[model samples]
Target chain A: MRPAGFLVALLLAAFAAAPASAAFQYYVFREFGVAKEFPLEPTRREAEYRTPLLGRAVPATIFETTEDNMVYRFTVADMRAVDLVARSAGLYAECIAMAEAEGKVLARMPQRVEDGTAFRVYGQLTSVDLAEAGGRKQTNCFLNKGWLYKVESIVLPARGEPNAAAALRFSTSLRFRIDQAPDSP
Target chain B: MRRIAFTAAAVFALFAPPLAAQEHEPLEWQEYAYPELGIAKEFPASPQRQTGKYQTEVVGENAVPSVVYFVDFGDLIFQMTVVDLRAPEHVLRAANILAECIFLAESAGLPLANLPLDVKDDTQFGVHGRVVSVDLNYNLGVRQTACLHKDGRLYKMEATMVHPEEEDGEAIARFVTSQRFELRKP
Candidate 1:
């Protein structure tokens, strides 16, 4: 067999040998103090996040990666100095506005997770040229222990509903490390 | 008397645009696209474009390059200023550029009106932008401004009415809502 064909066969064989969930790897990031599962190691970078009510921009760390035409991103910002309750509404509004910026928001709900308050939003992003050609996005925000965390997944229209399961899995797999809880923020 | 007349003529020349702007017939709306700037919006007429400098807190002390496309209708004014914050020294501050621009506008006006509480609120302006309406101090009328930051550029849009009492509010709303930002193609 040709070298290229042999490589394909090897890849197929590896996939067949492992269970679906076995492909994902779990990692603990001491710096961000969170443990999460990702299909591959996410690229880390420093970015800025906007505060809800104060209209200020604060430093944030972002982890992002793409797999099979789907994008997964996680962001964490320390907001210890700000009042979360007073700014909770702005926080939620900003998240939803971002989703609606590209498309229409399909649904949203406030969910009480294991340790924090999470807001889940579903959006249908429409293409500017072709309205029918659009993608789906899922954004989940968490306010826990004075830290604001956001997990987002985007599946291109080409990937469609086939990658929905993986997107959902990646978005829901973010777990904060309770043991390594840092300062209040 | 001749010196006074000469000064009066100079003053009138300086203010003639606004007075002449009011004499036009009904506005003919048109859509103008600046592909290089990554923005497209509607204007009452073909707006004249000017390049200038704008100072903001994020890029303190020194002013940055800016481009403004605007149309001055005697009774109304539509202006959009695009500030390039990608300079080597100011690039890192791009994320906070919009907040600083909003702060500058807020300082010149009264308190900000209540923003939307719900994300689904339809009252929100273009694509996650912060918008506020300011009542000018000297009867310059109401100026509604929206600031959006994207791709290291700060887009500031303003629709000002010189005679708000006589002008229709729908015209301002239409111009504000007609703005659409073009995504840069990689």
Candidate 2:
């Protein structure tokens, strides 16, 4: 079997046997200036993020993986523009609006992190699942220096508490470098 | 009683004489700096200070401490409010704080125009704020508000003119332009 497929199969087996302890691993991406926990190895790729207010797309890096009908996505976008303080405000509003678009926002909380601002938003997805309770999503977005960090989890309602815990672990694990130089490549 | 008081105040404001009718001299301006609050702004007169709390969506059930320094000149009023948001959830969220202030400022009157502002401060990361001009309800007057967040506090400066004349423009400009943030080093 292919290594990637083999890894997914292994994750599926482990998830079926023990859903709560599904081989989560701590990942530290120094280049991105963030750390988080992932249930499976995430595929990293380059993409462009749209900032509607800014009227343009910016270069971004995306890390994504899926397991047991749950999708996890983490994106780090470099806003290569002047006046990030203004841009960051617009970005925060944009992120919240995007999350609200998925469905009804159940809750939102502002958070202060080292050298930046973070927001946690919980919402129920509009799409319904026949086999599950419903669809849900939680997004944690952080704006530090000129970089925007986004962590998202989409899980079926049936996953319930385990997934909630997993989501919390994934988002809370996110940490940034305190003394790192700003806008370092 | 509250309604009666409000009605009396509204009646007084509605029938109040205009600045030209009163033939009042140009008001004196002075810079009021509160080192403890790390803010300084120009006021037409010595302002009376009041302490209060401001509620917002992100702050949850808890209310944040706020201080307001205001001078009511009958014809024109100048006020400044500083909201301390040093709570764990509100730290570094100056943008959010500014948004709330803007919302409140807009809610007070009908928005006529807005100008985006970049308020300079002592920190490398200054404040991104806005100046909103509004026409107050009940024909009260015109109000111009400038709001920003710096160093964990939201600063809002407002100037309300009962009937601003052409000459009153300079005083309004002076008050708004003279506002600055000089955060004291810890």
Candidate 3:
């Protein structure tokens, strides 16, 4: 009986030693015609989008990740401009202001890269440390053919930076509907 | 005779002045009409009136029913809308869905704030008024309001202020509630 118990414990230890696979999931929000893949399991929530100024459809998809317990949001809007950089700069200012208002600091040395004439990408690394709770977050803003597209992910645990990696991957995978154009003002 | 004539001319120039002098005076206030709002209003006539690009239009299909009017006031842009919910169930669903979406957006660090509902009792429409929401960082403000009338039509008002001001609240509220919708085929 002692030998049998030793064998059982050995089997349990071996099973636990096996490499565990990371949970990865993907979600597609049809209203915005955008898809996102996350490193951890996320719950889906539906949202209605409305703006008083444009009165345009502002539908969104929200994903709640498990590890950092951070909510990821995707929003798309159609806007037109003669110059892409000007519009992108305007959007970046708005995003930064919004982030600051929520008590999140803008990460220094943001990554900036050019995509094409119609699109440009910029990202930041942010952290929110409170007495009770603390976490790190990353946000990416995509300017596409007069459309302002944004994706943001947050991760808890100062060391486990899942959101930063996910945000980079998501930014590289962004695509837009060709038919939608910015509404005339 | 020459001295008399020069003196007479000098007196005339000093006292009579010129016809152009009257033009420099400020213009008086004049009653004007905003045909779109269906109300006659008054404004100072000094500043020349310029035609603006802003206009009113109905947006969204039956799947998403809303009407919007855009007005350009110099540097600011004002948008007003009337959303038709059609039923009580629609209102309840919309309210919850909108609230959740806003919360999710805010959690992601978007500039959405001042979310609240407006409920009141009246005769034509049992409930009316406006609910205010804002994206301060974006300099965007939204007002969502609703009413249920005896005609069995549920109406909602959404007013967006791109360049907001203190008086915008009252202006938007008045514009939204003053709207009249047809219950049946017009």
Candidate 4:
């Protein structure tokens, strides 16, 4: 087989059987309402929170994968239940109160993607909730057609493979399932 | 084939007078400002800052930390790299920065020509370099690279496009001429 095709096949296999080895793969997530792709199959969890604005139990599905010491996570918070209210600012500020963010956000810029504007923020991601070491996290959060989504990559140098390139690929590959027609996601 | 032409032109550029910018009307331009580097210049479009590492010398052994500002517009790939040349780990660094263009043009299969540059800043040195057309898998492209060095950092800006064929030389010339450098007060 051609080298490119062979590599793709190997990656897909690795992604399917992530527990067995350290190989990374392309994983498409359909568990959530929207489809997202992570580098590996990823462990999945769901959490429901009561919002102060509407007193509604909002649901957010979190998908995460650890490889080469890096952590990749995608959070899909369906705000349709709350009429797509912009409450992310409150959430971000509430978390900051726990521990002043290590430092200011290094950078945040609007990224033009297929659907619309996605804001990407990155810097030394530190939390007062946990003991600090060294590493960083980059997050891209955006609202598309009423749904709010966040794609995050945490660099863990102590873990093993601080594969930053792979971490970025995971975030950049995120889309609201292009197969669905535009404005429908 | 490309190597031979690049070597000869590099030798010729070492002694040649600085290339003069072609006369042309200004095109729409945008400012690319980097406060950290204390330098800013105009580009055809908003540029992206990319940080990476590269070989400090022609030997390709010792790696030098670098940040490259790059963009793609119309038919050209424009790039500017700022390299920290203070010290790598082992291999000796080249004192002259003009040689960087020759090495890069040869590896990319683009024929090169260059000459010493004269600019406003006394602490700065520059080169007016050009690359001829060559097939790059998908298309035939040529390149124009202008290099400058100041303090302990080397700055290089290059624009490459498919078969520029002398017609687009003015655009490349405009880019090289648009270069501006500032000296920070101690």
Candidate 5:
């Protein structure tokens, strides 16, 4: 009994000393519908609002942050009255042109997910040396519901397996729904 | 036994040729030194002004010029000229020419999208949009502009892009509207 008690105490101490893990939080909103949580340190930093083209409003929320250098952004758009496909295509074209002008090479092509959402991933080479923070890579994801287009941009360090793992985890959390709903519980 | 040994030797001689001679050669080495491509000279300073909506600083100057301008809200870098065109009537025409050139470049397989061109009569400025298309379906969100002052004396053209989702279209338009140009004497 004494030996078992000692082992249990040691395990508990080890668990307590370990750093807290970060996770991407997911939310569903009635107006914009579905968005994901980013792994950012402060929960408040994850939320942002913006007005897009044609005076449409969008609100983005972050769900998770991790040491692996990954952050997630979830944006909900209200495009019920607009042509969703044309708007999304035009925006996609616009984004692609800008990236090319900046001399950023596309590491991966746009891939369609099983659930009918399309996303494009890109990697940017850093202009300055970042030996300490590792190299830098950026990934962008685009999703459209009717006239509403949601964009997610993630910046990752070139090195560090932890960052890559965190980025993959955050990307897998994307969920979309057509019904209008609020994001918070 | 001796005869058999002699026959074997002759057969071996016929089957094998003498080993080829080996040669050794020394490596030739050369040394080279490159001349420095000296630093570029700065552009002539612009005259000081008491008040203006914009200010221009010569960041780099040479055959290829670069000027940094500070507007009301943000700053931009320009690689082209910031000159004073003598005629007021030529300002809009010059802007239209630049816009057409950009459009032609895009149509010739350059990935430029969402091309927005507008001439503001009150400010005498021309706003244009440009993007560098990447692959078949990816772009960076950048906008370019050509500003002509109301008097038509100053003309400045610029290329600008927002960091992904940093600011929306309305914010960008507001920023563009507030731009002013400061021309330097040649």
Candidate 6:
């Protein structure tokens, strides 16, 4: 069989062997005293990046991977460097600017999870969206436990369809270790 | 303005926002679908559909056709209006819905107030709307309307009732939550 065909068979075999619930892996961040689950292994490098809105350098751990033509990115930012992100105009403006830097904003909605955690979903309209015919851009942010967590995923029809349900599941699985539970916000 | 919506939805309006939690008992909801608009939503009962037309611009002579699907559950009325605006120039025309809403309240000889808070109620299918509230009229109660633009079409949803209580607020949230817009392939 051709190499491409063989790879498809291998991928299928792997999917058959993996349990449905084990699609994501969980990790515990000791320094931050937070435990969370992720879809892919954490990248080996830690990087400092500038937030266009906040205008400050903050430490960020990024997990990025591509599968079936879809791009997935998950970022955890330690916001301890600056004052708390006051739910004010500045924070709102920063969020809008950050999410829409490359594409026109399609929709932006904030949700308050049942557990009292708040999150916002930012949708961007992009050219690739019209080309892919079914592509969508979503940047999701959850502000909780003194950290800002973001999950971004793009759905391209030519690739496998993106799993919004799984993305949301992974994001909601964030937990604080028992040791830090006493002071967790 | 403080962006964080408070339970101080208490201090600002004397009532909390319906977006946060469904604090009331669930009502029997029936699925409502509008194929002409390519959207479906859950409503407590069958809604009354109203069709009308208004000028896209206050001074323009062209009439923009519109439809409103609404229902009243006791003291609250939930309404959704779809305005056909496939014309490229309709972008600016869509915005006039807000002022049109204001004009409507004033024409009825009622005092209306604008709440600067922007509600973040966007569906997963990519429709976002902006919310504003008004005093409406003596008997009609308060009105909160959200306007959304997509595919050269304008969708405006409104929740209006007189003297809304906590239960009414929860019901309004339910109405907003149940809305789902269908994005069909061309």
Winning candidate number (DockQ): 2
Location of the lowest summed lDDT over 10 successive residues in candidate 5 chain A = A120-129
- Report how far residue B36 has shifted in candidate 1, in Å: 0.7
Q: Write the per-residue lDDT of candidate 4 for residues B4-23, one digit (tens) a residue.
A: 99999999989897544343
What's the lDDT of the predicted structure labeled candidate 2? 0.66
lDDT of 5 by residue, B1-186 (tens): 999999999999998875332221221212111111111112112211122222121111212222333222122212222333223223322322222333333333324333333332222222223322211224433454433322323333333432323333333334333332222211
Kindly indicate the candidate among 2 and 3 with the higher TM-score. Answer: 2
Candidate 5 residues lying further than 4 Å off, grouped into runs, are A1-19, A40-70, A76-85, A96-103, A114-135, A147-163, A177-184, B1-186
Q: Which regions of candidate 2 are displaced past 4 Å?
A: A1-185, B1-25, B183-186
* Tens digits of lDDT, candidate 6, B11-123: 76765464443233346678777767867767777789889874533314677888988886656678887777666444433323333433343344243432222323233
Higher lDDT: candidate 1 or 3?
Answer: 1
- A34-149: candidate 6 lDDT, tens digit per residue: 55565665553577646544456778777665544455566667664324332212233333335544354454433333322221122211122323354655665544434555
**Total clashes for model 3:** 1
What tier of docking accuracy does candidate 1 attain? incorrect
| Superposed model 6: Cα runs more than 4 Å off | A1-22, A82-89, A100-110, A113-134, A162-165, A176-185, B1-186
**Distance from true location, Cα of A1 in model 6, Å:** 36
lDDT string, candidate 2, B1-186, tens digits: 999999999999999975453355468788877888887788878889999987775444678899999988778778888888766456544445555565566777787755556555675545455677788888887888887665567777888878766677677656665676754532
lDDT of each: 0.61, 0.66, 0.40, 0.52, 0.35, 0.52
- Write the residue-wise lDDT of candidate 3 on A35-147 in tens digits: 55556645667554343322244444455554434445555554443332222323333443344344445342233344332222333323333223456555555443345
Chain B TM-score for candidate 3: 0.35
Evaluated at residue B13, the lDDT of candidate 5 is 91
What are the DockQ scores of the candidates, in order?
Answer: 0.02, 0.05, 0.02, 0.01, 0.01, 0.01
What are the per-residue Cα lDDT tens digits for candidate 2 across A39-114? 8888899999886554568889999888776778888888646644444554554564566556645554334444
- The better-scoring model by TM-score among 2 and 4 is 2
Best prediction by TM-score? 2
Model 2, position A1, has a per-residue lDDT of 61
Query: Which fraction of the native contacts appears in each prediction?
Result: 0.03, 0.04, 0.00, 0.00, 0.00, 0.00
